[model samples]
Target chain A: MYRALKTKPWISLLAFAAPALVFYVIFLLIPTLGGVYYSFTDWNGLFRSYHFVGFSNYVEAFTEDSRFIYSLFYTLKYVLAIVILQNVIGLGLAVLVESRMRTKALFRTLFFMPNMFSVYISTLMWTFIFSTAFPQLAEKTLLHFLDQPWLGSSSMAFVSILLVSVWQGAGYLMVIYIAALQGVPRDLQEAATIDGATPFRKFLHITLPMIMPAITICAFLTLNGSFKIFEVVYALTGGGPGYSTEVIAFNIYQEGFARDMRYGYATAKAMILFLIILVITVTQVAVLKKKEVEA
Target chain B: MRKRSLIPSSLIVLLLIIVTIFFMFPIVLAVVNSLKSQGEMFKSVIAWPKALQWENYKYVLTEVHILRSLYNTFIITILSIVGIIFCGALAGYKLSRTPGKVSAFIFFLFLSSMLIPFYSIMFSLIQVASGLHIQGSVYRLPLIYIGLGVNFAIFLYHGFVKSIPRELEESAQMDGCGQLKTFTRIIFPLLLPITMTIVILDILWVWNDFMLPLIMITDYKSYTLVLLASTFFSEYSTEWSYILSILVLTSLPVILVYLVFQKYIVQGIADGAIKG
Candidate 1:
C-alpha cells in the first residue's frame, strides 16, 4: 500500500481537487450551459411547460430591441474610458510613492481608504458631497466645481461613475505597481542616472518596460471589473437620465429582479454578456501576453 | 535651478493635496453629515460636527437592527472564512505534493471558474439553489461563496505551499508520523503568512459582498450590513441626512479593518496583483 501510494501521486491530487471540481461542474459550468439552453426557449421560473422558439430570442435582441445593443455600446465606452484612466492614475500614484517620499505610507492609506468602503455606501456619500459639500465649500473658496450637477445628466453621470470607480480602484492597483516598481533593479537606474540620462528618459525606458507584467494584470482586472460593473452604476445614477447609463449587467438585473421577474429574458441577456466577456478576455490574454514578453 | 524648483515643487504639493481631498472628502462629508439632524444635514455641514450624534449609531443598532444583521454577517463571514482556509489548505497541500494529468485537469477547471462572470451563472445558480431547497439559509450561502472564492484562495495557498521544503515532512515520516500528522504538526504552522493573506482577502470580499447575498437571501433576517444600508439608501434617498448618516456608519467597520490590517492587506494585494 505504501509503495502504491508513493507511485500514484495523481490519486492524491485527484482527491484534493474533487470538491472544487464537483462544485464548479454543478454550480458554474452546468448553470451557464443551462442558461444558454433556456435562452432558446421562453421558460418562466414557475412553469414546466416550455416552447422552443429557436433563435428568436437572440434575433429580438439584435434587431427588434435596440436597448441591448445600445447598452452594449455605452458599456463599451464606459469601460474603455475607465480602464485607461484608472490605470494611468494608479501608475502615477505608484510612481509618486516609489520616489521614497516621507509620507508615502500616509498617502497610501489615504488613497486606499476609498477602496475599503463598499461602492453603494460611497455613492450615497458622494450624493451628499456633490449636492451639499462641494457647493457649500465652493461658496467660501476658489475651488468651487461642486455646484455642477454631477449625477443629473447622462454625460456627467458617466463621468461621475468613472471618477468614483477610479478613485476606489487605483489605490489597490497602486500597491501592485509599487511592488513591481521595487522589483526594477536599482543598479540599472544608477547606471542610467550616472550616464546623464534624465529622469523622464529613464522612466520612459526602464520603468515602463519592467512594469509591463503588472500593467497586463491591472488591465485584465480593470477590463473584467469594468465590464461587470453594476452596483456603482445602480447606486449612483440608477441607470437614469433616460436609461443613458444602463450597462448590460444592470439591464439584465433590472429585467430579472424588478417588476414581474422576466427571468428567461434576463438569462438570455446575461449569456450575451458572458460571451462578450469571454471573447474579450481570451483575445486580450492571447495578444497581450505575447506583447508583454516582448516588451 | 533652485529658484525654478520652489514653484513647481509647491504646485505639485498643492495638486496632490487637492487630489487627496477629492479622494477622501465624501467620507469626511458623510461623517459630518451623519451627526446632524435632518435640517442641519440638509443645510450641509462640510466641516466637523458641532456636536457628535450618538443617536445615529443608536438608530442603526436599534431601529435598523443592524446589530442582528451584523450577527448574521458575522456568522456567514466566519464560517465561510474557516471553510475556505481549511479546504484551500488541504487541497493546496495535496496539489503541491501530487503531480499528474487529473490534478492539472481539476486545476484548469478551477482557473476557468474565476473567469466565468457571476451574472452568467447566477440565474441558474438561483434555479438550482431554489430546487435544492437551500435558499434563505446560511448553509446554502457558504457553498456558493466557496464555489466562487475557494479557487483564488486555493491558488494563493498552492503557490505559498510549494516553497515549503520537503525535508521537514520526510523527518516526520522517519519519526513514524503519518501523512496527516506531518501536515498538521509540521506544515500547518508555517502557513501563517499565506493563511493571513487568505483570511484578509476573504474577509474583505465577504464583508463587502452584496450581489451574492442580494440574490440568495430574500429574508430581511439574513441581510448583511451592506445590504441593509443599501436598502436604507434606496428607501431614504430623499432624506439626505439619514442617507448620509447610514452611509457613514456603514463604512465604519471596513474603514476600521483597513486601518488596522492595511499593511497585510496592501501586501496581499501587491502579491496577488504583481505576481499573477
Candidate 2:
C-alpha cells in the first residue's frame, strides 16, 4: 500500500483531500444541491414524500406572498442604504483617522470597538439606548427630539435598524479603507498640495482613484453582508411594526422554521435570495473591477 | 501661518471627538447602567451610579450559568478552528501542488461553494445534521462549522501556498521524508502567517455566531455565550439592569481578545478582504 501510494499521485491527492471532501460533501455540497432540489418540490418538512413542483414556489414568492414580497423590497432598501452609507462613512472615518498624527490609533480603536461585539449584543445595547436611555436623556436635556418611538413606529424602526447596522458595520469597512489609504503614495498627495490642489480636489482626483479597489471591496462586503441581515432585525425589532422591517433571511427563517414548516417553500425563498445576491454581487464586482482598471 | 492652519485642525479634532463619543456611547451607557440599580437607571440612564451594584454581575455569573455557556463556546470555537486549519491546510496544499484537471476542478468546487449563502444551505444542512444525528451536540457542531468554513480557509491557504517555493518540499522528499511527514514537519510551520490570519478570522466568526448554534443546540447546557445571552435577554426583557449586565458580560470576552490581538485582527481583516 505504501509503495503503491508513493508511486501514484492520485492516491496522495485522495489521501490529502479526503478529510475535507468528506465533511464538505456531507455538510455543504450535498445540502446546497439538496436545497436547490427541494426548492422545486412540495414537501412540507413533516412529510416523507415530496412531489416536484417546478417554479410554483418561485412564482408564489413573487406574486402571491405579500409578506415575502414586502421583505424582499425591505431588504433591497436596506442593502442599498447599507452599501452606500457604510462605504461613505467608513471611507470618511478612515480619512479622518488617517489624517491625524497623534490620535490615529486611538480614534481607530474607539471607532472599531463596537464591531468587536456581536451584532445581537450591539442591537441589545442600542435597544436600551433607544428605549430607555434616549427617553431619559430627552427629559433631562433640552434635546426633546430624542424621545421618538425608535422601534415602535414602522419608519423609525427602519431607521433604527439602519443606524445600528451602520454603527456595527462601518468600522470593518474603515479598517479596510485605512489599509487602502496607507497604500496611496505620499509623494502624490504632497505634489498635489504643492500644485495648490484643494483638499477636496486632491481627494477627488488623487486619493479616490488610488483607493478604488478598496471601495470596490468595501462595496462588495457591505452588499453581501446587508443582504443576509438577520440578527440585527431578529433582536432589535423582530421585524416589528407589522413585518415592515422584515429582511429576506428573516422572512425565510419565519417561513421555514418559525411559522410554517413549509420547508420546500422556504427553500425556494432561500434560493431566490441566493440568486439575487449572486446577480447583484456579480454586477457590482464587474462594474467596480472595470472602474479599478480605468483608475 | 501657524494660527491659520491651527483653526481648521482644531475643528477637525472637535468633529472627530464628537463622532468618537457617538461611537462609544452605547457601550459606555451599557456599562454605566449595568452598575446602577433599576430605579436609578430609570431615573437617569446617563448618570453614574451612586453606588456600584456589583450584584448585577454576581447575579448573572451565579444564577445565569454564563460561565458554562462561555466554556461551551470556547470548546466549539477552538475545535472548529483546529479542524478547519487541519483539513484546509492538507487539501489546500496538496491541491495547489498537484497539477491536473482533477485538481483544478476540485479547487473550483470549493471556491464556488463560498458564493452559496448560509441561508440557502441552512435548511438542508439542518436536515442533514439530523439525518446523521449530528445536531444538538456541542461536539458535533464544530464538524458542521468545519464543513462551512474549510472552503474559505482552503482559498486562503491555496493562495498563500503559491508564495512558498517548491524546492523546500522537493528537498524534503529527496531526504526520504514521506508526504505526510513533509507536510506536518516542514510545510505546516512555514504556513504560520496565513494560519494566523485564518485563526483570527475564524475565531471571531465562530465565537460570535448566533444562528447555527441557536438552531443546532437545543439544550441549555450546550448554549453558546451569544445564544445564552440572547435567551437571558428575552427571558428578562424588562429588567434593564440585568439585561445590560448580560450584554456587557457576553461581550467582555471578545473585547478582551480583540484588545490583546488588535494588531493581528486588523491585519487579518485587511488580508482576508484583499485576498478573498
Candidate 3:
C-alpha cells in the first residue's frame, strides 16, 4: 500500500482536484479562453460561423467607437474617485469607531447595515432618497442643492452613484480596517503617547503604518471593485443622461447583450477592461507591498 | 487635563453621531415612508403617517409574487453555498496535502485566474451556459456559481487546512477508514471555522449577486429577489408607496441575517478579504 501510494501520488491528487477543476474549466476557464479567441472573430453571437477579424474589433473600440472610449475614461475617473474616497472614508470611520469606549458596536452595526443588502437594493433605497425624500426635504427647508436632478441630470447622477457606491462599500472596508486596528498593539500607542506625540502624530507615525496591510487590501478591493461596477450604475441611472455615467462594464454589457449583441466586439472591450484591471492591480500591489514591508 | 480633553471628545462624539444619522437616513426614510399613504408621503415626507398604509405592503406582497422571488433567492443562495463549500473543501484539502508538481500546477492554475475580471468572462460565459441549456434554469445557476466561486473558496480552505494538524487525519486513515471517509469524518469537521467563514462570505455574495442572474435568467418566473425587486421598480416607477414597501420587504431578510450573524459576518468578511 505504501509503495502504491508512493508510485502514484498523482492519483490521489487527481481525485481531490477533479471536481473543482471540472466545474472551473467548463464554466470559467473555457469561457475565458473562448472570450479571448472570439475577440479576434466577427461572431455576432447568433451565427455559429464566423471569420477572424484580426485586431479590428480592438482597433474600433479605441478609435471609431467614441462611446467605448468615453466609457473607458469615465470608468477610470470613477475608479480613481472611488478608490481614494472609499479607503479614506473607510479608514476614518474605522479609527473613529475604534476609538470610542462606548457606542462602538452600535455605530459599527449601523454603518455596516448597508453593506448587508445587495448593491442594487442599496442603490434602489438611495434612489428613493435622492429622487423623493431629498426633494421634499429641500422644498421644506432651504437646502436648495438637495432638489437638483439627482439620477436625472449629468453631474448629479455621477454624484448620486458615487455617494451610493461609497456608502455601500466603505463600511465593508471599515470592518477590514477595524480588524487591522484591533491587531495593532496597545503598547505601541502608549509608547508613542509617552514620547510626547499628539493623537494626529501617533495616527500618522504609528497607527497608519501598523494598519498598512489593511489599507493595501482596502485599496485593492476598491480598485478591482469600482472598475467592474455595474449593478450600482445599472440600478441607479441605467447609464442615463445619454450614457454619461456608463462605466466600462455597463458599456460592455450594453454592447454585447442589451444593444448590439456584438459578442466579438464586446469581448474585445471586456479584454481591454481585464487588461486595465490587471496592469493597475499589479502595479498597485507591487508598490503597496513594498510600502507594507518598509513600514 | 480631563477638562481640556472634554471639548475634543465631545467634538468627536458629535461628528460620529452625525455620521450615524447620515448612514441610517436611507433605511429610516424607506421604512417610515413605506408606512405612509401616497397623499401622506407627498404632504410631509418627514412626518409619521396618521394612518398606517397596510395596503401598500399588502399590494406588493400579494400581487408581485414577492414571496416567490424570496423563495427563489433562498434556493439559489443555499445551493450555491453548498456546492462551493463541498467542491472547494475537497480540492483545497487535497491540493494542500499533496505537494507534487501536478498539485502545484493545478493550484497555481486556480489562483492565477483570480485576476480575471468577471466582466471579461461574462459574455462568453453566457454563450457557454446557453449551449449547455442551463441559462434559463434557476437550479442550474448554482452549478455555474460553483465553477466561478470554487477558486476563492479553495484558496481559503487550502490555507485553513494548513493550520489543522495532519496527524489526526493520518491516524484516522491508520485505523480502517478509506481516504474519502477519513476526510469526511476527520478533516471536514475540523474545517468548521473556515467553513463558517466561507459560508458567510458566499451567502452574502450569491445572495446579493445581480449580474449573474440578470444575464443567465431570462424568465420572470425564476427571478431572484433583487432582479424581481428591480423589475418591479422599473415597471412601477412612480408608485413610491408600493416600491418603498417592496424595497423594505426585499432588504428585510439580509438585515435580519446581519442582525443575527453580525459578529461572524463582520469577521468572515475581514477574514476572507485579508486571506484572499
- Cα lDDT of model 2 by residue, B1-276, tens digit: 111121268778988988898899999999999999999998888888999999988898887888889899999999999999999999999999999998999999999998788988888898899998888888889999999999999999999999999999888888888899999999999999899999998998999998899889988889999999889888999899999999989899999988888888888888889877
DockQ in order: 0.52, 0.60, 0.64
Docking level for model 2 = medium
Q: Going through the candidates in order, state the TM-score of chain A alone for each one.
A: 0.92, 0.96, 0.96
Residue A158, candidate 3: Cα error in Å is: 1.5
Q: By TM-score, how accurate is candidate 1?
A: 0.93
Which candidate gets the maximum DockQ versus the true structure? 3
TM-score between candidate 2 and the true structure: 0.97
1 against 3, candidate with superior DockQ: 3
Ranking by DockQ: 3, 2, 1
lDDT of each: 0.77, 0.90, 0.88
What's the ranking of the predictions by lDDT, best on top? 2, 3, 1
- Put down candidate 1 lDDT per residue, A192-252, tens digits, no spaces: 8778777788888888898888888888998888899988888878888788999988888
**Candidate 3 C-alpha error for residue A257, in Å:** 2.1
